[model samples]
Target: MTFDRRQIVAGLAGLPLAAGSASAQSGWQARFPELVMAVVPAENASGLTGRMEPFCAYLGRELGVKVTLRIANDYAAVIEGHRAGNIHIGFHGPSSYVRARTVTNGGVEPFVTTINSDGSTGYYSVLYTRADNPAASIQDLRGKNLCLVDPNSTSGNNVPRFAMSRMGIANPDQHFARVVYAGSHENAITAVLQGTCDGAFNWWNSEQDSNFSRMVNKGMVKPEDFKIIFKSDLIAGSPYAWLTALPADAKAAILKAFIEAPQKDKAAFERLSDGKDRGFHPVTHKDYETIVELQKFVDQMRRARS
Candidate 1:
């Protein structure tokens, strides 16, 4: 489904005034006693929840409303939460955000995105294999089992397919002996290291910041155990979005809290970025138009395969 730019612009223009005179005195807390922030866990659910606790508390303190974290099982669940209005805020990968927008019909608006330490607004999708595996490239891994993160993942699935077609492997499902979704970035990496799959697509901002690097730093895996065979061009950083129905003042307050978290809530900010980000930066739908087009292309590819 294509988005109407005029409708989106008109809706955005009236968002802040949505709460109207009722919110003028008491604000969103009166109407929304509690807000849920939904996320698809990349690692251990319990651990991720723990890591995000302080951030949720920070938001709660800033907004004068109770904020709770909801660990969604998959990307589609997160998208569905936004579509159903069960979730008030979301942290979504680029491709999944586009899917959410598509499913929600522009009900959600991206407010901010993470800025990499190098000051880039994007990250790379890398194809990896075990270090001991003789397979050195995507070609070498032909007819081998492959692991992907999620169907709606930007780096894990979308960019991987796009990059593979560029490399002359147009259909990964046909090229590989088997293709499977590991459901999370950590799962994809683990499958590769454990020999459950020959290769996997995951994200990398730099050697200093990535799922692999974070795992390595945590002593979960050694750096020598894996090798990167291929890397895709920079994909837009994921976004933290909110339902546009929120009061205008509430939106401003939420954005202000996020932009100031780097200084005011250093530990929570570091936890969110794994200590490798500069900070959060404002972004709009326009920033992800290319990603939306890419998602459309992938959707067409899927339909053709079916």
Candidate 2:
């Protein structure tokens, strides 16, 4: 089937504007053994899929089913996949998961969130400028071009919007000389280095491992080459989400897979998470209430602007 970006966004993220066709029934596990897991494509899709194989294999064993991985090229694709019942499990950003409930009309449930290296179930949404930009603060970046990750991204767009608003910049597009969507964290980081934008919005694990650090390690750039101008209070971590349409037993098994996968298959989980994550801790919609509220605020702001 052809990739459907439009349907995905319709069921994924609002166009700053804003489906419930799910029915959770028993025997879903028996009827559908191929559990389709959708992952947000934060980087190269093919490479990510290959790197995730070992973890998927391990999950398959735990569920006693065949696990098929689908790399949704952006956050919205994963959301739509879930709404269309094409996805069983989703490794979702906090903002995307929060948006899923509204987009799916309550067809999704977040079960657990990754615990980062510092033992927190969250990370930071940060702004970075070139090392020599001479910008000491977000105020300094006003009238400068900026790059943001996907609109559905937590650190990339959602939290940045909220944080920027709180910083007294009610309009990033107007304050920043120009606003560009860099598509992914890596791209946003690269954009700053390549002068695509004056600064960028990205994220960091609690360990301080971020796009900059990752680039530094890859010989792509130096740690001193970028300056952190703004860092939002920790946003809820990425979540292991499930469709409400799944059978109760299936959901239980999936949640168990997340909770135990780290301890039982430490190396695989670490490999899957690129060493930025430790494991998942039990969580509920309430744990992300702040993000829910933030999203509401973002919607209100966008509406007011329109």
Candidate 3:
């Protein structure tokens, strides 16, 4: 058959131009699995991979979609991907979620939160000092080195900073000898343990099965090596969110799958959900109002310092 240039041009022009429309219609939408699951390099990448691959495979099988894992080097990269909508579904810390929302002009919405096995959706940021250190409260750490997890961490930095502001200990930089970003909560905890930092801030729930307690019990760190000098009130847990442009059916399916997953596959669910949190629960942007308020406070503080 002879090629028809004009006819071909017209045909091509009429083809669907909407991004991801074809895939969405086929019920096999794509997602960045690694980013969506918050698998970090420092946290035993091999173990994370081993644990998540099967989980992703299971989700894909049950959801009737293909899921691909994408790993970014740091939290900022993950946040950027989320802002750009390259990542359809993501697990983001509260501070990172706030930044993503700010950059995207509120384009994202929380669909569900990973619940603890006990069905709680909250965690706390704890301020720790060496067991031998005399600091009794956040105020006592004045003129000392303070190690923070990261700028984009919720329990690691944002909540701790907000807590300090509430306690009238505004700007640890001014009060402390210096403020150091340890890059990760584990690092911050390590810094305090090694005597490199006078104190450190980290996220954990007091619940016995919480991540922090699990780490301590697993001998990842010695609980006796540090003491909690301060702790923030429970903050909402991280979210599993999607961009607002996601189709309603897909959104509903995703939420339904997550919320109902634990009952279907208890063993697999236990591996992903933090011990006490049962599973994901449906949520909306309104649920994160406190986070938005916290971000505003942080932004105001940044401006004041500048």
List the candidates' TM-scores in order.
Answer: 0.91, 0.88, 0.83
Per-residue lDDT of candidate 3, residues 214-237 (tens digit): 557547777677788887888887
Candidate 2 steric clashes: 1
- Among these predicted structures, which one has the highest lDDT? 1
Instruction: Give the alpha carbon lDDT tens digit for every residue of 260-300 in model 1.
Output: 99999899988886788889999998889999999998998
**Candidates ranked by TM-score, best first?**
1, 2, 3
Better of 1 and 2 by TM-score: 1
Model 1: lDDT equals 0.83
Q: RMSD to the native, candidate 3?
A: 8.5
- With a 3 Å backbone cut-off (N, CA, C), the pairs that clash in candidate 1 are 16-248
Kindly report which residue stretches of model 1 are placed more than 4 angstroms away from their true locations once superposed. 1-25
Task: For candidate 2, list the clashing residue pairs, or say none.
Answer: 143-177
> What value does the lDDT take at residue 49 in candidate 2?
70
Model 3 TM-score is: 0.83
* Alpha-carbon lDDT of model 2: 0.78
**Model 2 weakest lDDT span, ten residues long:** 14-23
